[model samples]
Target: MKIYPFLKNLSLVYVLALVVSCVGDPIEQPIGKFESGVLIINEGSFGANDGDIHHYDPISGDLQPNVFESANARPFAGLIQQVRVVDGLAYIVANTGKVEIVQAADFRSVGAVNDSKLKIPRDLQVIGQKLFISDYGPYDENWNNTESFVAVVNGLQGGAVHKQIPVPSRPEGMALIGSELWAACASGSQLVVINPATEEVARTVEVSAGSPHFFVQFGANWYVYAMDAERVYFHRINHSAYSISETISIPLANAIYNGNFTMGTNGDVYIITTSGASARVAKVSIETGVVLDAEYFVGSNFYGLGFDSSSNTLYVGDHAGWQGNGQVWKVGPSGSLIDSFQAGRGPSGFLFR
Candidate 1:
């Protein structure tokens, strides 16, 4: 009778252990505060060495400023021009001639590409294992970027310059369409296409008579916006033909010159332009080639524009004339301001996860 009770207790303990094993740890670990949110890239003052990033949570409506310097314990030197996230790392291209790489989730500085050849680097594009940096080249005696080129880095982790492919002047935003890498020369009216395999200029497609600055691809077409002394031109390029298919011009009086733009999920393009201290967003319909709203959303010194497809929201950054802290406004789909949060100095761009 004593042995019977001992056997029963042993069986109960075994069942309890089995139940504990079946109830394992959480299926997913909680993500970092900066991991699943919008990253506001503040270019900072040109000579202040205060370039930083701000994290914003759309769900909680919370803003965390200076996340980059807080995570790395050091200020990000130089003007942060643009940030591109590939795989899980963020390649931050600074105008002061370097590309700083960091973890996209935590903003930890992991590596950088500081080749001496990267002068006034503007943007970054990665294809496969190679990183292409668009540099304005060193300034001449007259301060002209006449030797602009794209520097190629072999790998992301501790990588060096593999080669420098010469392109048109002041290459800015880049896009990979089909198998070719297209770069918009911000100082010329040319869209330079490069062959990634050979790291050479494949060809140049002439756009409207202006400086091509940015590209956004929707469907089988790529939309590019260029600005000249008189007006701004939006060119729709047929990817298969590799040529400009349509050109829509916006008078300078209506929409000023700006390179910041984004394509919405509905195939519409939203561009940001500044006039004096005030900025505006112009909406253009890709199907009809018409400017839908000349001043869809207006704010003070709006310098950055991004469309979040998942939430159908528009995020605009007001740089505050580079005088102090900037602000980011979240606009609804109907062009109504939902909320605004204070960001870092010179908030010029945004990356939404």
Candidate 2:
């Protein structure tokens, strides 16, 4: 008997689990119009064409899986990266090639952008009517930097890359502070600021030696998370000086990975980190720059973290390796487990709607 390519690297014990899931159809409910729920992005196994989005309704305790393909009557190709609900449409960035736009009311396909200029779209941020996306430009055939850029889309006139603003390599997370856009250089140790009006690189702010790959905005300041450095920086941008007025740093024990950090509704910052023994979510005070609680949510094999401000709920994604289906754990604001649902292969991040 020959092993398949996707499962060739699995251990003998885990191979049985993977075969059980692959052979039998996993239970999945048809997607529906969600009144209020968290939209979970599952980055299915690589090359399995299983990347999908699931809606978990807290009110009804229903898990609507594969909402994208079910509503569109077509499978979402490539890896489902990031998703943002703007206006009435949900912009789903499928990093394998394109960004899928769907109706927020009902997970239905509205439009898509897959221009040749998009090399590896990582993140998306909306400003007024424009959509700014960071593309981690891949190395060309010659194995050299291909010049990563931020592609601008006129959301008012359908999704299309009207212009591209060149930036540093491997741009990831992005946030809008007033009229300026702050983008993190994932492979570099700096944050690039761009003027949305001019669509030009205004300036770059140097940070600790690490990849600043994630961000969250609270009030007038911006919280930039340097994943490699395990530090979250509070940057107060001064318009008059065109520089950071004040920067406060919060140190952590473990390196932050994708979907590890999120902000709470009560103005608290929560981040998931591992301490060798177990994965833990830490709550940090925004005002004092201190860890209010070190082990807010603790579990083994935890991969992602998200907070729902409306109901004060905390959602965690646990991936027990690539052998079986992943899980989305629902916990209260106090870190009590409410419920858990079976999600796709890797339930990475959540878009609370």
Candidate 3:
């Protein structure tokens, strides 16, 4: 495997300048219409904590290392778990128990949405004009803290969290439909539905044959392709009834699972995982029930997955051990590893900036 060279080392002095002003071509200036850029979690606090977001340059496939584009985080945390961008603002969800709002242009702080009321935030999504954030509550696996909650902030209401709701158990990921919210509970193995307008528990839908972990909506159905350490489970959802659509065993003697994914324009779903103790990116054909292919990612672990909708450059977060170095891989549409750039630690969830 040929290791691609980085355009600018993190040690380069003009890297930040290069990030703002393009160095070549018949035309200069970063060539991306916030059409859908990526807000990546590059690094975090020393011990698996909070991270920052970058305006991922996918056309050229590079991580523009910025000095000030971090979450308006409070000094020290483990990792910035998830983030989503809409209307030129990056909504960064920090697992260190904070939600930050940063300007999309220069990546600076604007405001923050935190629930000192409810702690340990996990995933977030923007639907219509509202922001729905999921709280993982407590870390039962690590015995950290295991309660679960959800907060609905009306973006129309000045990003004001108008409602705070509770769920049956801890949430790993979530999906939204208009005014309805659906979250996957790690413990209950149920997708709990909530109506933020009424702050009421509406319904509970079971996902997969086993437990559901992550979800994304494509076309008319919401697809929850999840893993519970041993197997990969796929569920095809059409609003109400969802059944185990497919089940495939991952080829790993000891699989280190990371809960993040990206869906292609053609409805194919991608999950980043190891191919038997080796760093590889696995692709599944959503239309057909098969593990289509796997690409080498050149790292120990991956966090978030981002794809440039137009050019189809795949961006992956390189989280080696939740600390020290974080790198982002740039892979071509055909799963060819091309280049990479150093990112932050414990990077999870990415939004196209």
Candidate 4:
């Protein structure tokens, strides 16, 4: 027989094509696409336990014990206070008056700044190529009579001190809103706007009791989130028109150490109240003081709050030491617990670029 080779092969090819179509999907659900973050908690070595820097995954909800641990990485043999992760470098603030740079990928010590260079650097704020470190100068062990310094350093220079610009008193938290460096004087309720070009204090935005912590600039407004002896104040942004027009309270007394908050794309504000007995993160419409939802971390240690606009994910770190292993949790748009991951000690605060 004249073997009908073409016809015999055609049937087999058609069957194979049908089998391929019945296979699984090519595009998998991006459940874990959201990048995880590191929590660098200063293990207070005094009477407090050594602070732990934890790594948390928003996808898996796992909290690793310690990411960066050691004496050199640990500035004072005390605690690792503040941290700024730029590119892949981790700039950690040591209460003993030094800032150490570690590999963000592995938390290995890359370099460090001495006391003479950085006098008790608190949280870090970056502008262009310069890093504006909140230098709350050291005094007696009782931590009295302190003045704030904004040490502008080269981002690439590991421990090199560029120039230390003096502010009013003990600047703890800082935010680079537009071109102005708003210094949050932790000891005093004052916001000094610094000019990065001249390193001069342009003006001061007066706050209530607590000083400004982490800030977010939204819609021609620089929200100066400050707190005093009793309450946390939200000073609306007015760059070209600088003033504290409207302010709001936390509904609870003393919202201190609340670094966990982020402004949503829709102009909504999300905040976590750790200082209060509530120990929860609440979402609210910034235009109104209405609470839409709140996430109560009753038993967990909570500290810093950050928002990622890309995936619309919210990150929170644990500051309490008793929690042992700290955490970095992922909150959904509705302020729901989506996922979590393991983290290092005290995962104080994190920045997502």
Report the number of the highest-TM-score candidate: 1
Give each model's whole-structure lDDT. Answer: 0.82, 0.77, 0.64, 0.64
The worst-scoring run of ten residues by lDDT in candidate 4 lies at 29-38
Who is ahead in lDDT, 1 or 2? 1
Q: Residue by residue across 1-353, what tens digits does model 2's lDDT show? A: 98886676567658888888887977675544753677888877777857888888778888888888889898887687788877777888877757888788887776778787887888888888787889877787876545888999887434668898888777888877667898888766678899998889998887654467777677766667664446665555564465666666677668446636778865687788876757888888777877788888888777777888788888888876766789988888777888888988788788877
What TM-score does each of the candidates earn?
A: 0.88, 0.82, 0.75, 0.71
- Can you write out model 1's per-residue Cα lDDT over 79-129, one digit (the tens) per residue? 889999888888888898788898887989899998777788888888988
- State residue 98's C-alpha deviation in candidate 4, in Å: 1.8
Q: Please state the error at residue 91 of candidate 4 in Å.
A: 2.1
lDDT of 4 by residue, 90-131 (tens): 777776676767766666677766648666677777677777
Better of 1 and 4 by TM-score: 1
lDDT of 3 by residue, 1-353 (tens): 65445534543656766765764535745733433456566647545443555556555555554423433334424456665666777666777767777665655667777656436777887777777788867667676444677877776223456676778676768777555777887667777887766767798776545556777766776667566665566676656543344454343222335456778767666677665445666776666656677553545666667776766778877776554767777788788887777776655556654
Among all windows of ten consecutive residues in candidate 2, which has the lowest summed lDDT?
227-236
lDDT of 2: 0.77
Against the true structure, candidate 1 reaches a TM-score of 0.88
Question: Model 3: residues >4 Å from true position, as ranges?
Answer: 1-38, 46-50, 58-63, 66-78, 126-130, 139-146, 153-163, 240-256, 275-277, 295-299
Local lDDT at 167 for model 3: 80
Q: RMSD to the native, candidate 3?
A: 13.9
Better of 2 and 4 by TM-score: 2
